[model samples]
Target: MSRPPSNTHDLTFYNGHWYVPSPPIVAVLMMPLAYLVGGKNISTADFSMFFSASNAVLVFLILNKLVDRQWIKLPRKSILWLVLLFAFGTPHLWVGISGRFWFVSQILTVTFLALSVFASFKSWSPWIVGFFIGLSVSARPNGLMSWPFVFAIAMQVMREDGQTIDLKKMFAWSFKSAIPILIAVLSLLWYNHARFDNYFDFGYVTIDGDPVVVQNAKTHGLFSTYYIPYNLRVMFLYLPEIHPDGPWPFLPSGAGMNIFLTTPALIYLVRRYEGRWWILGAWAAVFFNFALLIMYHNTGKDQFGYRYILDALTPLTVLLAVSLGKKIPWHFILFVVLSIIINLYGANWFMNG
Candidate 1:
C-alpha cells in the first residue's frame, strides 16, 4: 500500500513528494482513467487487464494489416490462432493480473513497442517511428536499444523501394524525427534530476529504500558479470515448484519457468527462416533486450515466466505471426499448442496459488 505518489513496487520519498524510478508515460496515460473512475477506488489490476487484452486486439489488427500488405500471408484461422496465442499464451496474462507499478511499465512498454512497429509498417514515416520508439524507451529504458533496429529497418525499406541512399536527406529526416524523442528523453532526465539531483539516477540507492534491491544494486551496480548465470536460469532453465498440499497443484511462490518450457513456440526460432526488414528488426530488438536482461541484477522473481520479456513480446510475437504465414511445420504448431496448454496451466496455478 503506497501513499499518494508512492508505488507499491518501488518508490522514493523526497521533499514531500513520492518518486518512482520507472518512466512516467504510464502514469501520465492513466491519469485520465484514474480521474474518470475515482482514483481511490479504481483497481490497477483491472486497468492492466484491460490494457493487456487491448494490446492483443492491437496486435491482431497490426497482423491483419501485415497480411493485407503481403508482408505475411496466412489463412484467416491461422491468423486468428496466432493472435489468440499472443493474447493468452504468455506471462502477460499473469503480469496483467498482478497490476503493480512495475507491471504497469511492462504493459505500457509492450503497447508502445507494438505501436512503433505498426507505425513503421503503415507509413514508414521516420518522425512517427522515432516518436513511438521514443515513447517506448520512456516507458522502459531498455527500449532505447530498439533505435538501431528501427533505423536499420528504415534503411532496408528504402533499399527495397529502389530509393537511393541519400545521406544528407536521411540525416535531415532523422534529425527532424529525433526532436520529439530528445524532448521526451530530456523530460525523463529532468524528472530524475528533480527527484534525486542526479540526471541518470533511477533511485536505486541503498540509502533510499527497498533493502533487497538496493543491496543487490550496490553489489552488482545493476549490471555485472555476476548476474549472467542466474539470469540464464531465469530466462531458459527455471521451473515451477510443485506443491502437492494445496487443493490444486498450486505453484510455489518465487517459482519461474523458462520461455522454452512455458512458451515452446519460441523453439521455432531454431529453424531456418527468411529475413526481411521487419523480421530482422524484430530479431535485433529481441536480442538487445535479452542481452540487457542477462546482465541486470534482478531476475523478476515471483513470476510464472520471465515477465521482463513482455516488452520484447511485441517483436517476438511479430516473428511468430510471420512464421505462421509460412508453411508452419507440424512440429511448430505442436509446440505452440503445448505452449498454450503450459501457459494456461501456469496461469491457473498461479492465480489459485
Candidate 2:
C-alpha cells in the first residue's frame, strides 16, 4: 500500500513501479492514535508500546496460570519480575518505543504469538490458536511454521489425562486447526501472485539497492547453508565493537547483536527439559520457525537488537518459566536485571540515532 520513492528499500518492483510489502495492517491498527494526534505518522511511536504493554499483561497472565495449575510454580513476586523481564529485559524493550514500520510489525508478531500461546495455555478453542497463527504469519511469514503450536495444544488433553494417543481425535484436532492456517497460506500466496504474478514470490529478490543481499541471493540462493555461519555469528557469537573514544563505547554491528549478550537469561533454555510432550512441541515450534529465519537472506539492518529472535520469544518464555520451576534463583534474577540494562542501552541508541 505504501508508494514511496523509487530508491526506497523494501518495495517490490511490480508491473511498473514500486509497491509496498504486505498490506497496511499496522497503519490501520494505529488509526486511533493517528486521529488522537491530529492524524500524524509521528504519533505511531506509541503504537508499538501498546502491543508491548499487551504482551506484558499476557506474560503475567500466563505465568500466573502456570503457578495456579502447578505446571511451573513461582511466587507472586517472581511472576511480576518475569513479567518485567519480558517487557524490559529483552529486545521487546527496543521494539516497544519505535514508530518504524518493521518494528511495529515485529512487536505485533510478539503480541500475536503471545495471544496464541495464551489461548493454548487456557485450553481455549483450538481454532483461536490457529486464527492467531494466521494473524501472526500475516505480520511475518516466518510464523507459518507456528503450526506445531496447534498440535501441541491439541494434544494437551491426552497429555494431561495420561492417556495414549488416539489417532481419530488427533486427526479431528488437526483438521480443525488447519482451517485458518490453510486460509492464511492461500491468502498470502494469492497476495504474492497478485503483486508479482508469482504465487510463491514475496519480492525479497527485488529489494532495492542492496547489492550484498542480491549477490548472496544469486551466489547462494535466497535460503542456503552458506548463510549459516554468518547468521550463527550474528545470532550468538557477534559482540559489540569497542570504541574507546566514541561516546557510545560498545556499538552493535549493523547486522545485529547476539541474543545471549542482550539477554543472557535465555541461556537457561538449555535447562528446559523435554520430559513433556507439549514442551518438546514448543521447542520444535520455535526451532521450526527459527530454521527458516536463520537461513534467509538479510540479517536485519537498522535494528537495536536481533529482531528475528523475537519470533520464538513466546515459546522461549514458556521454556523459561518451566526452567524457573518452584523458585527464582538469585543468578537468574541477576541475569534478567543485566538484560534490562543492556536493552535499555539499546533503546537509547536507537531512539537517539
* TM-score to true structure, per model: 0.87, 0.91
lDDT measured at residue 73 in model 2 versus the true structure, 0 to 100: 69
Cα lDDT tens digits for candidate 2, 1-353: 34557367766677776866664457667677667765744556676788889989988887776676667767767877778778898878888788677778888887877788778777667688888887887777777676786477558745675756788877876787678878877888898888889988777777664689877877787798788888888888878888889988888776788888988888887763856766777788888977887898778766766878878877788778888877889999899899899989888887784
Per-residue lDDT value at 185 in model 1: 89
Residues 1-353, candidate 1: write the lDDT tens digits: 33564333466666666667678888888889788877887788887888898788878877776677667777545777677667667888777776787887888777777777666656567788878878877888877766655665566666666777688867966786688678778988998888788898877662355577578788779888888888887788776666688665646335356787778787656645577766777788888888998898777766777788886887777677776656556776677677778777777766665
Error of 1 at 168 (Å): 4.0
> Candidate 1: misplaced stretches above 4 Å?
1-9, 15-18, 207-211, 248-255, 329-331
- What residue runs in model 2 are displaced by over 4 Å at the alpha carbon? 1-7, 27-42, 157-165, 272-274
- Per-prediction RMSD in angstroms? 3.1, 2.6
Candidate 2 residue pairs in backbone clash:
none
TM-score of candidate 2 against the unseen true structure: 0.91
